[model samples]
Target: MIYVILLTTIVLYAVIAIAIHFRKALHNSNSHQINIQIFRTLFLIVSVNIGGYYLNYFQVLIIIPKLGNDIMAIRKWNQIVGILLNVSAASNAPILYFTSTEYRNAFNKEWQTIIKLLSFCEIAAATSIEQI
Candidate 1:
């Protein structure tokens, strides 16, 4: 169940990244009729992510919440899994930025900062989860 949620969230994150890519592609060039096929593909991807996220969210929040406070073992396992999921999801941001030509061209050396931010977020999330 948790795996499903993480997988879906990862897919959604990819779609969102793709959307950003399309937006950048459009803005980068003056070319008209900027590829409907790409946009269509991105839109479909984004839609899938949206659906997956919601499905995952329902399973995590609603179903998990009902499990109550006594399920410490399950709760700990979920927390660890959630932390890993968030860390993995967040780690992709730097890759996304690097892959997007616009971002890479714009930031150049400073792109490392974006990566650093992702690393920081992952570390922070993991640390917090462990502390909990």
Candidate 2:
């Protein structure tokens, strides 16, 4: 099912992220430690949220179908799970943006380069137009 695929993807990402975190932490640098801690907390929160959502999904889709009752309860649980999942998904971007200085700096550098290129292109265009 789709849930299985989503769960698998999340687990894979978590494993890779944890491995990278550990590798960075092994460096024993203070800044790496701080960044690792921040990312660890974020990963924990997101993992819990995703786990709860998947558990609720499994219960609603698999267990409930067999039981063939408690439809209202399943519906309510699904709604709550859906909301939690959405919140977790939405928070991921902001959490990374705020926590990772390297990411922000790289983004800024790329933006500046883009701006410089655009200005150069504009100047080149203007020169060509004048020559014509």
Candidate 3:
């Protein structure tokens, strides 16, 4: 089931890429790129997951050996894939901060609000401590 899902997704993404690649309208020379490498990161996340699934599937169906080089290699591969998963999750903020002006503005605005709130809390704490 996991294999089917992952294979299907890979096919779907291939189709989408081919479609976009051969789009009817010739892409302008000066194309405005967006998303801050989001697609590449997403593709990495999806593709590496197949390794993790393969490890699980083998363990379930074939009874992966208790200890062997092949099993150890697969386990190591799955571990690496698991860490790759964090790349996509952890990269969004820095990517958006660099790529999107809107994200920067919004982030700065929210950050200011946090700073103000923290300062207010500090002042309140100081006053309360003095009273005590």
Winning candidate number (TM-score)? 2
Task: List lDDT for all candidates, in order.
Answer: 0.60, 0.72, 0.62
For candidate 1, the TM-score is 0.35
What does the lDDT read for residue 27 in candidate 3? Answer: 41
Off by over 4 Å in 2: 1-5, 16-32, 38-95
How well is each residue in 23-91 modelled by candidate 3, as lDDT tens digits?
544344433132223345445545555555665566545543543558677687566655655554366
Q: TM-score rank, highest first?
A: 2, 3, 1
**CA displacement after TM-score superposition, residue 128 of candidate 3 (Å):** 0.6
Residue-wise lDDT of candidate 1 within 1-132, one digit each (tens)? 866865676687677656655564454465423444345444554454445455546657776777776588557757765665555445434544544566557677676888999999999999999999
Span of 10 residues, lowest total lDDT, candidate 3: 29-38
Name the regions of candidate 3 deviating beyond 4 angstroms.
1-84
Q: Could you give me the TM-score of model 3 versus the true structure?
A: 0.45
Q: Judging by TM-score, tell me the better candidate of 1 and 3.
A: 3
lDDT of 1: 0.60
Query: Candidate 3 overall Cα lDDT vs. reference?
Result: 0.62
lDDT value, residue 68 of candidate 3: 51
Candidate with maximal lDDT? 2
Give the local distance difference test score of model 2: 0.72
